[model samples]
Target: MMATVRNPARDAVAFVGVGTTPYLRDAGGKSATALACDAARTAIEDAGVDLADIDGICGSSVPTVSVQAALGLPAVTWWSNSSLPFSLLVIEAMNAVFSGACTTVLVYHSSLRGAGGSKTAAADPFRVHNASDAHGHNAAMTAESPSGTYGYCAWAQRYLDTYGVGRDALGLVAINGRANAARNPHALFREPLSMEQYLGARMIREPLCVLDMDPPVDAGDAFVLTTAERARDLGHRPVLLHAATSGRTDRPFADQLEDYTISGKEIVAWRLWEKSDVALSDVDVFFPYDGFSIMALSWVEAVGYCQPGEAGPFLAKHWSAGENRVLIDGRVPINTHGGSLSEGATQGAGHFREAVTQLRGDAGERQVPGAATALVTPGGFLWNATGFVLRGG
Candidate 1:
């Protein structure tokens, strides 16, 4: 039986402010708590709201209590610790606001991976030494080790094999992201990456090169959400949350995935579209997670932008022709802030920030002209997927 689809609680809540600390390779002794506070304070100020007005807080990776203490908030009536992919935090914040549990809410993400504070183990999943075996490793070891790339590489290979594409198609994704990053001052890698450079990059895993991965960094991103009426009374323009949805596949592990080429985004995208008036064609900006270049392609296909396994040709036709193709003014502007691939990884919050900025017409150099709607997917790894459709109000 098909479930009844209902429109999202449209305009019930909206994002009024977005903020982030300067992404850095190392925060130079700054703790995740401190970074979260910095971003939260900035967001609070950006929204023209006082700290006391923040009745709710939502985050993952960093504790909400620490953030509240660091910012010295009077009290928070609602708080939640959302898990992975970052988009869940946004949805949680919206839920809190709509339930009247809180008038204004803060959602944030902070990571200290690049500061050597939370370093991944050196285990390589592809190679099994006498002392260590990939299949026998515990869940903690698997999640905390750099060896995870092995699974992503496996998916990349299967994608190529299934679609009859080559490594060059993946190169196009990297090239497009780097090109956008070159124009963003806050991006970690701002230099223009040519196809020659992308193809020649060091191989991290077969078919997946160094350029295909997002570098871990120490940074924080935050946003303020409130009722649309309250948002209008605040400083910045409100970016309405038209729809949001999240889901995970029963096959959680990479080896157990039902389809190597598919990420769980298709599930979220289906619900997101069913719950919103907006369609893919109505999106002026698209921000699909690019923790890995292939992940972005997976999302592109999952969201019905193109047929499954055809994202390579679609990108080649639309993203290959320099600035005139997918830039801010192109047919489909994407990842205007360069995404996690180029914009220092903020655990996908950077994508949300850019989406709000573009909708507000404040993305100075990377602004998508007349951008009224945006679709953002913060999912990869064929699990724990979340998506949102936002409209400018």
Candidate 2:
């Protein structure tokens, strides 16, 4: 017999508040702990709640207990310091709220350049020998050939060779993100990135250039989640997380996995679609994680946006010349906050933050008109694929 499908937690929890520190090279000499605390404090205030109201905390790259104490959160019934990419932290907090383990959860992510990130990062007294890959700084991935990351360069080469396409296929992705970043005040690299610039950027890997990767920054993003009912009572308009799931292939090792034929994101999209009660047509905005430009293209194709190996043409067709960005079908905008490429890598935190901001109609210059549904596909292939649909209305 086929297994039963159930989604009792659908829309049970909602995001009521979000806090993002300015994307910066250095966070005014503050430590990761300080950055987390600052974001957490802003999130609490944004939710219009007292510190005691936070009964749970979830994050990466920083200790949950330290954050709790720094913010003077009385006693969290649930706490976890999970892995990167941000979606895992959201899932954990959402489950805690739905399972009655916690009423309110503070979800946060901090981006810092550890010693492995760059020569500057290595020279910083604060980052000496940190060697931790909290988020894809692109430097560590280059220096060490990190697993999930460098693995994509090979895939990019294959995608190009398979499609017989030029560098413009991937160059457009970077250009589009930088164009959108121009309008986002919070983005770090807002300068116009033309196709020529993307093509000429330093080649870190054979097929992947520096512009194709995500740069590191000292930044923080936080969100306040609670029961949907309670969320309506909070300050900002609640963005309901309708469905969430992550996927991976049977092949656990990145090197041993089959490529193109099976993408973890396709599995995630299938499950998310079933639980979300909607399809691509219903989506008002799309936020595909862009830690690497190829990942965004992968999502564009993986989630039925187009056939396999066609994201280049798909993006080109959706290109808005006047706006200098991709406006899907001349309506839905992808990664309005510039994405990981220009927003600075919070892994996937920037995508979620921009989605919520768009949904709340607070995105100002980058807002998608009447955006009510947001599809956020975060993380990437080989065991990190994760995504969720948010309903704003």
**Top candidate by lDDT:** 2
Which stretches of candidate 1 lie above 4 Å from their native place? 114-148, 261-263, 324-329
Per-model TM-score, in order, reads 0.90, 0.96
lDDT of 1 by residue, 1-393 (tens): 157987647768999988889888766767777778888888988999998899999988677988888788798999998776678889889989998999899999887653122333123221112211211234356444544466678889988998899888788777777778877888888778778888899997788988898877768889999999899998788999999988566776766778854446767877888898878888898998888888888878888878878888878767637472354224677787888888876668899999999999999988877989999988675666788899999
Per-prediction RMSD in angstroms? 5.0, 2.1
- Pairs in steric clash, model 1: none
Error of 2 at 221 (Å): 0.9
Error of 2 at 79 (Å): 0.7
C-alpha RMSD of candidate 2: 2.1
**For residues 285-352, what per-residue lDDT tens digits would candidate 2 score against the true structure?**
99998888889999998888998889999999999999888999999888888888998988899999
Best prediction by TM-score: 2
